[model samples]
Target chain A: MFSWFANPHRFVKLSDWLVPACYVLAAVGILWGLWQGLWIVPKDDYQGGDIMRVMFIHVPAAWLAMASYLGMAVMSFVWFIWRHEVADIAAKAIAPLGATWTALCLATGAIWGKPTWGTWWQWDDARMMSVLFMFFLFLGYMALRAAMDTRQKAARAGAILAMVGALNVPLIKFSVDLFTSLHQDASVITAEGPKMAAVYLWPLLISSFGHTLLFAALVMTFMRAEIWTRRAAQLRARLMTGD
Target chain B: MSGAPILSAFRQALGEAWAGGAGALLPLGFFAGTTVLVPLGVGTEPATLRAIGPGILWVSLALSSLVTLERVFQADTEDGALDLWLQTGAPAAAIAAAKTFAHWLTAGLPLALLSPMLLLMFQARASGALLENMGLYAIGGIAFYFWGGVGAALSATVRRGGLLISLIALPLYVPTAIFGALAMGDGPSSASAPLFLAATTLFALAAAPFAMGAALRLAAD
Candidate 1:
């Protein structure tokens, strides 16, 4: 099964249908989630009031930010073990999207924090700092990939890096937690499981799924584009050599 | 097989790094220079300097370690010693470990030694805490070298790898920085940070060699 889709031609054909389907599902889910969250859900009494509506987008973006890295790490593993071309392409495709989501998460969190915590940034927030570290990890991965001269070299080096980054992610989170606890303040946010009501929880779940589907769609679209780009380069090289 | 080859590789690496007296002293120089500049940039108020002293020291350590990272594999690879080492049939990870051990000896250890002076200059009062933090710096510096070794190995094939190595390494340095800083902080809770810092170094010891070996092989290819 892996071999069947490992071929770029077959992968492209499959993604042609898969990409559109994912995008459509993502659009519906996201739109519905926004409606439910922004209009139907009651405002929080203790927090930012109507400003908490941003949680609809904020939570999902944050969830996808972490999820995307895990996704890349899994693809990196596949590429490292099997030398799967699609796996490399998929991992490469997911990076910028993941970085963007992470950026969005930070921005939204900042916006939410401004109204709720009276600060645009919180150094003592473990979640915020770790997410920032994750962003830097993404930047490093992208930079390393761009630095390598050959595709295979880039893929292998990037796979190793992704694995290393994956290992460090948890350590970063843990250390940040410990570091923040040493300098404790009365934080508005806690690490406890969501104390949110059903109305808020359901929308968050739906939006999170929507974001996942959206990420899948974007990765597939980018992968298909990358496959074609490689094919074109190969064809051009062949034609030039023949001449 | 005999351990002779690994030992020689280790010695060769150490000798190469120390061959030029200036190269051996570059990180220490950079560490001290950066530490000096911090006060000039951030104002010399003793309380302010003391408050941020540990963080500044760790950042300088991280930056200074990166200054030498490109040379970790670049010089060997360029001169074909790395190729010869690969042909020796020793595990690439073992070779990488030896080389990185040499790097720690030459670059990392000095930084740890120099850190105490900077800490004193920054007006950290507690002698016992300063000594403990110095010990943590030694451990953390070893971890930094190994982590930077992975970056150095990955970018060994690139002609200008200095910036790329920094980009690749500084993020990996985040945990070490956080833990090291926390360990230097006051209170009983801060004591656990050194254990975490040690754990990070141990993890780097086990993980970096393999990652570096794989990346070196890729660069060789």
Candidate 2:
């Protein structure tokens, strides 16, 4: 199914237009989400008034952080079984982007934590620790990929690492949760019976979509850039053969 | 992938690691040294030491396991033994399981044995349920070694891959660390924590070898 991703000409032709379209759509969504979240959303006095706004950014970033890792792992599995360069490339491209979003999630989460929870970080909080482990998982993937001497070896090593990480991440989360869970027990359940007020819910949903779109655009751009870089390297090698 | 005895590789790996004498004891030294440092770094209040005792020891043990992994598969790769094993139709996963179990016997088990003395250093109770603690430590040690073995195999071909191995293995060590630490908590007779710890060990025991095998295949590449 993803064999099309490995076809350089098709990938190039498709991404050439899709890339620009993604960028435009991503910009609009992110801007509206930001504008609505920052200015248009009302302050909820039940929680800390303005600090709650951090949720608009933190929540979406957190969602993307988890999603991107899963995407990387699935791509890695495809490459491991099918030996597709594009799948490998997709996995590689997702690592840094996933890491960046995880960092954002951690930072914004901490920011929200400070005024609301009165601590910048909580060691026992299962969500925070699991996310931090996720950050390290991304770093380990990139480091393992970088240490390899050849493209094939890097892809193979990275694929193995990513898959292992994907499997263990859940166990890590479960273990951490079992020992101690300091985070709120489903904020939606706090007096609201798990039904978020529609006002907050709608914008949060839109903003999350915006973040997802932005992430997709970024990943596509990265994959396209890597494909071009590989092409250039091959062309250079061909030129060298003339010597 | 056969469950039949692959003890020859196990015996071979054990003999090689045991033959290293002083080199083989490096993780033991590293484990004890790191455990002792915790009290020195933080003031030696018995209450404080006892509070942090099991958790710190687990952390040290996890870190020390990295030392055990560097040579597990790398030695075979260097000697061309890895290639031979790949070509011999001997199941890579079974070979990996044998090698890692043997490594646990030599490098990991000693650290598990040493945990009591170190826990004593922290002024924690090493007498009550002493056997239970030892059991938990040993099981957690196996889990650590198996996960560590996967990292070792993945980096078998890379030079100075010790840090990379640690980086990769540490996250995988979370379940064992949590369950092991908690097993020491809520009293010793309580079965839940140990059950969770044992379950984690068994899961790693079952799953990590295939990963190690796949990684060794890549290292062979």
Candidate 3:
């Protein structure tokens, strides 16, 4: 599977059909989720009524923010060990998406929190701070890549960074948890608890699945464009050398 | 491998740091300047200063460590010292560690020793407690220098890479800053706080050298 997907042509061919299919499915899933979340489900009074609906957007974005960071790191590892250009392209593609999802997560969480937690921001909140830090890590990876003068240096530096970050994500999370616990009782997420009804659970799960599809589709599209741009650059170089 | 490589690298780094006006002292200046700004920026209420002081100091120390990292590998890369070292057949990881250890010794250690002064500025007393907080700064120093060194090495060959190094290092500084704050906070200071802070320090100590080594090789390329 590694070598199979390692080929840029294969990726291009596969994503040609897959990308469109994903777009349709993601649109369906997301629209249905938004519709159900906003209008269908009965908001519990104890859960802060209408504001809890933001969970459909916030929870999925939160999960995908983390998932895509790991995905980028995995791609970086693949490129680091195998020197597959496609893996590098995939990783480069994923960084902005992961960052965007993280931003969405933060924004929606803040929106959700204003009423529930009584504040728009809580610096001591472990989850908020961890996700915020992860967002910076993603941006740093991109900035590091851009700083390198050569593509190879950029890939190597970015790979080392992504791996280092992936290793520390758990430790950062744990330390943030410790820091918060020792300092104060952060507005616990236990307000609604895990006793979520099936009505709320199904939409949340489906919306997460849809968001995952959308994120994957976006990554594929970016990778495809990058591959084409590289090919064009190579052709231009060849022509310039011949001339 | 023998300790020769680390010892030599550490010695050479210390020598260079000393001759270069001991750039190690530079972070202390920045650390102090930042401490001065915090009270001015936040106003000089003793309670407010005391409450926010630990966090602000840990964060400033983390930032101050970053200022010196821009030079960590840049000087070696510019002078071709990196090529000479790599050709010496030494383990790259060891060399990276030694230099970073030396960096901590110079830049990070002074900041750690001066933590008492910072605490005093925040209205802290108790000489015994002051020394303990200084030790906490010592461990926090390890995390800061090693992780920041990884960024410095990665950006070593890039011209004007100071901002890039800060971008890369700041996120990595999170655990150190967080744990150090926990260790220093008067509220519910767990015995485990220092242990967790040490764990972050040790984690960075173990991991960052290899990353710096890899990045140094890339810089040499």
Give the whole-model CA lDDT for all candidates, comma-separated.
0.87, 0.86, 0.87
- B1-221: candidate 1 lDDT, tens digit per residue: 55666787799878877687687888788889999899999999999999999899999889888988888898878888888778777788898999999888988888888877899899888587777777898999988999999999999988889998898888789888887887887756687888888999999999999999998888767
Question: What fraction of the reference interface contacts is present in each model, in order?
Answer: 0.78, 0.78, 0.78
Q: Write the per-residue lDDT of candidate 3 for residues B1-221, one digit (tens) a residue.
A: 46676677899888876775645567788999998898898899988887887777788888888888888889888888888888877878889999999988888889888888887898776579789888898898899999999989999988898899898888888888877877777558656688888988989989999999999889888
Per-model chain A TM? 0.91, 0.93, 0.93
Per residue, candidate 2 scores C-alpha lDDT tens digits across A153-210 of: 9999999999999999889988888646656566453674647777787778778887
**TM-score per model over all chains:** 0.94, 0.95, 0.94
Q: Residue by residue across A137-185, what tens digits does model 3's lDDT show? A: 9999999999888788889999999999998899889877754421223
Clashes of 3: 0
Model 3 off-target regions past 4 Å? A179-194, B1-5
Q: Which 10 consecutive residues of model 1 chain A have the lowest summed lDDT?
A: A181-190
Docking level of model 2: high
- Writing each residue's lDDT as its tens digit, candidate 2 over B151-216 gives 999999999999999989998998888888878877543468888889889999889989998998
TM-score for predicted model 3 compared with the true structure: 0.94
lDDT of 1 by residue, A1-243 (tens): 667778888888888898999999999889999999889989985667998888889888988899999999989998999988999999999999999999999999888889888889878788888889889889999999998888988899999999999988988888777644322243323487556566778888888888889989999999988988999999999999996
Candidate 1 off by > 4 Å? A179-195
How far is A27's C-alpha from truth in model 2 (Å)? 1.4
Better by DockQ, candidate 3 or 2: 2
